[model samples]
Target chain A: MNNSQDLPLKNDIAARFLPLIIGLMVYVGTLCFVFTLFILSATHLWENQLRTQITLEVPASPGASSAPLQAQVLQVLSKTPGIQQASAVPKKEVETLLQSLLGTTLPVDLQFLPVLIEVSLNGREPIDIPMLEARLKIISPQIQLIDHRPWQVQVSSLINASVVLASTLTFLVLLTALVTTTFATRTSLLIHRQVVEVLHLIGATNEYIAKQFQVHALKQGLIASAIGAAFAFLTFIGIAALLEKAGLPSTSLSSFSIQAFCVFALSPFVTGGFMMLSARLTVMRGLRP
Target chain B: MSDFIAQFVGVGHQYKKGAEIFKGATFNIEPGSFHFLTGPSGSGKSSLLKMLYLGLKPTWGSIRLFGEDPLTMKPSLLPLLRQQVGVVFQEFKLLDHLKVIDNVSLPLRVRGIEAKRSYRDARELLNWVGLGDSLQAYPATLSGGQQQRVAIARAVITRPQLLLADEPTGNVDDDMAIKLLHLFEELNKMGTAIVIATHNQRLLERSPYPHLTIRRGTIIRTPKRSKP
Candidate 1:
């Protein structure tokens, strides 16, 4: 039967409120996704570029010709196998690096900090850090290797926390959407109890009654998801622009994987399906008694 | 199927934590027969009709509709059986939000009939009931008698095998009540079994149909007059 014309009870005031609520929730969820994507992409870039690099620091000898010692160290590093290249960092460049961190006002005692040398590995063979340190002691006893592994571990932990937080927020968003749909559907059932009775009296099946709510919820979900997804997309673009202005790595939206952005298109359908499922379950439970 | 449209043997109904509403009642209604149930307020007439229409199950004793015991009927089969029966309540029970035509077409729609065809039939029935101009008007806009007619139109739209009406003439004046009676008579002549529960004595005296009078949840039967 064409029961669509039977009545307009499905689209009540409460039903109208669902889309906006769901939209707000979806907005929150999509924002979480964007944050996680940004963190992962930046971490991946850092890993790729820094994994094969090492640094050596040389203490300035109090009374020796620092030039001769620097020259000798550079010569020994060049002779080591698996070392693709070695160069003494310019003092002025090291000061520039310090300016970025410690600012331009460097204390006179801090000027004796150390001379830094950057070392690159060919990546084809593994070099033991202890053996390399022992060999480097022959050129100068003050040479210390600074492998980036510990720093990488710290960065990995930070990325892991971001991902966990994003996943938790997305889960909460889904739960909120499900709870809201259930509340709306149940309220509608209570509000229109008389209508339900009349329909039941006329031999309408429980499935038919439940379908009324399902269609209404699906429509609302689609609308809310559209608004939420669109807002999320715009927010991501804005964040990308801000990050680019601030010189953060991987600031472009396309810099992330396609799966990262695909969420924007799929959000509405997922929420719509969630809404339909919630309505069906709620209506059936309401009608079963 | 049993030859009788409805049969009740020592049927009883009792509400939870409440006194008994049915006190061991027994009765039968033959197919294509028309009978009137006369009773005062709270005489259990509506409750008995409810049992016959599967709105409630008998607390004790055997009860059958269309020759099958409704007690053992599966829930999945309820809609199919309910579609074969029609009921008009004392309150008219019309959905206030639905228009007159949509309200009248509800039974057919529940039976899986297409709205296009049901609306056409609903329109014709509304015209027949002198509510043709009110087709597009909601049930809340109609008078008490008009709502009652819409309920009748809905009940009989599918041409159910049996029709049970509780206090069909309760809200209307004597003239309107008589007009509604003529409508029921026409449906009854078409081989539908009809059982009307009412408090109007004028109707009982004017018609030759047998009367089943209920008092204190007990029934007293009076045979129909032989045609001259």
Candidate 2:
């Protein structure tokens, strides 16, 4: 009999906290959705910028060696404030990448592959590629300074599109939360209407009733958010793995840094708080004449 | 611990100018005194009960309970005072969602009684009301007489000093009404003040105690208490 009596306590907990839990889960899920898109787009933009700094090509002529030309370009690059480190890439390494893309055997001579020099920059100021090209031409007319702004602009635009999309999704998620919270609170109040009346008749203050709802909503929100976060993380990891297998650009989805993850986790608490506020307002309004 | 359980002086109530429900109603229910309020339909029997239970304030004049004017009673203290007064509705307003035992035990629970003790008393009262086998049944599943029994059980479970019942036996058969009357008499013997509102002449004829009759929002026969 005693055990059975405690069962109602459990029921009370469930009834009070369930909506909060659901709210939290939805909040965390929305955050993860936005974060995943942001990470993929941001990393893609960063990688694209890294790839477009320079392009090199070598002639089939036996005398066409880039070693001396690379040395001269390095001298000019060292003096440039924005230039970080510049070094020539070995021909064999470039050949290997081509082989992976183009096949093991080729009709072309190995000398035709480019001796590429990789440039690292401070990214401080926009590179004056034309002026640098004129200076580089004085050392070796074959030397060219590549600005990479066209491809950078393209990648940046893609990043901007991603941001806009994520922001739109975030807005939709917030609106959904607001609607759900309002409806859930309203439904709960309706269900407990008589109990509310009884309490009022017996002299329970509005603040007391509001406190009960607040506690229950917060509890539900936190539990639901935790579940939602876990589910979103699992989905993110699963998608990242599948993409990796398909040879697409794959970064660690689980690599969501502490600060980012904290933001994601906090989303549920915010939702619960909103729900609590809505419930209090609804109850107060209903109690009024 | 107040000298007066309830007091109303010059109380009047009306609904939208149809007719005054109660006009210049003045009365006092002394501590531990039983009262029976009787009247024909629309004579404000229920309305007077409402004022006593704090459900409605008199349209005119002052009303007090527990020796304090209700209008000035702090809202926070209202629940504590109400917990001491229990009411049974004419329709047997039992919560249909709860089991009979649960419904009877509600007052105790609301008063912060531990479930273990409250349920023990609830089970005993259910048995006393001849509802021993139906403890787990919901109000909706019970017969009209059974539901009234459940309501009475709930009303008295808290051992309220004042118990107000409106038309408690109106829905029950004559035999069951007599049985419920004995139940109320037993509670009254135990020092709980009981007020039952009903139109049953046969039942009223059997009781030796005095009762007040209302007509046109006025008390025609005021019950006089014998001096202790």
Candidate 3:
């Protein structure tokens, strides 16, 4: 609020702690970048669950025939209450999905891939997998049911761990920022010792000196945070472009809601508040009589 | 509650890991009076002054400032009292990073005084001290006398009720030292209490004020002088 004086607030701080600030910005930026990725992946996994709940496979032994079994499985799925749609995925589609994991060139011909029937369910009712499997067995003795719960659990766990890891990294970044601000504040105080003592002599209160530091650091940290957030956004766009070109799953890391966007916008503000607190505490403690 | 601004009774102090420095020292500084504290090196003059400034507590006995006991004063309230007293240290202690004007204006700035007004007043004081042209110069580039003058300007800028100078003229020549002394005297004339600690006999001889002489850890005597 005191504007009687103009401080080269950003310029002076950048000059004094250029490397540290840059490093902080880059570290936060990278975390934000990865956070976006995790959010997108989590959303994709949720979307996948909403779209496909079950997979039915049929074996192809010497005398086995999948065409009749596929028809029977589709007929059973259509009668189920929660079942919305059922469709047979041709052999080639399955082979293509396996190609990524097995190799570009699979060992056998494309027709050799197992016949699969994808089942999508609707309405909020949880599917009874055991009953469905039992009813599905009456259609074909060779039918195998994959409810996708196990895979969903695995994906959810991975997403949860990723989120927890990102949150932990963000916490560590804040701690580092506090430590960094403390050191800078101490150095600044030592450099201004005479000024401080002179102010003390002039009857200037300790709170007044501490305010200057707090305000100055708040500005510094906000600027660094803006730079970091900007970098994060740009990196997100670059990664999105890379994934698009690679023809990978079209997952989106963009802000999903106002709240999500606000959280991103507030990153710098939170960082600034932390730096202000650390600097103020450091200055007062150093000047304590 | 009386008119006395400061009172020290049976005060004693010592540096850690060192012998007792001051022993049962006693003094009183009235609301608006100029006094000089003189002592040789190792005579504990700085230690005694530190006690007066509340920078160090007396090892024994009681001291009072502004009618309040310093021994029991809360840390939160000490700054309120300290801000009413100005200090000029022996080494000048000017911050090297700030320009001369900024250095001179620091006390006012620290007091949360408006910077424009503080700077305006600081420039005037610097002009008064004959260092107006050095306003933008850093302390390291200025002569020792100029730095001391800046220090003096900073000390008086706040218009504190009590001004303490510790060998302020130690780094200046005879003429500059006397000029600095006169500045302190001028502030004293305006009813700001002044205390100057120095070993310079010339300044003592030139000024006409009561003097406290210290030897070892105690005040040897107090002398009254003819009016300046």
Q: For each candidate, what is chain B's TM-score? A: 0.95, 0.93, 0.95
Q: Specify the poorest-scoring 10-residue window by lDDT in model 2 chain B.
A: B219-228
| Candidates ranked by DockQ | 1, 3, 2
As for candidate 1, its clashing pairs are none
Model 3 chain A scores worst on lDDT over the 10 consecutive residues at A1-10
lDDT of each: 0.83, 0.71, 0.75
TM-score per candidate: 0.82, 0.76, 0.78
Instruction: Name the candidate that leads on DockQ.
Output: 1
lDDT of 2 by residue, A1-289 (tens): 4223211222452255455546454655566454756566557656655644654232223666656766667788788767767777766787788888888876556675555677777677566677777787787666545556677678777866777777777667656665665566666667677767765554355665665566666666666766776566555556657767887544443444454456556666776676567657766666554
DockQ of 3: 0.34
The local lDDT score (0 to 100) that residue B110 gets in candidate 3 is 69
lDDT of 2 at A213: 64
Model 1 residue B91 lDDT score: 84
The runs of at least 3 residues in candidate 1 whose Cα sits more than 4 Å from the true structure, single-residue gaps closed, are: A1-17, A51-144, A249-251, A257-261, B1-3, B16-19, B66-76, B172-179, B189-191
**What is the i-RMS of every prediction?**
3.1, 4.7, 4.9
Query: Going through the candidates in order, what is the number of backbone clashes in each?
Result: 0, 9, 2
DockQ of 1: 0.40
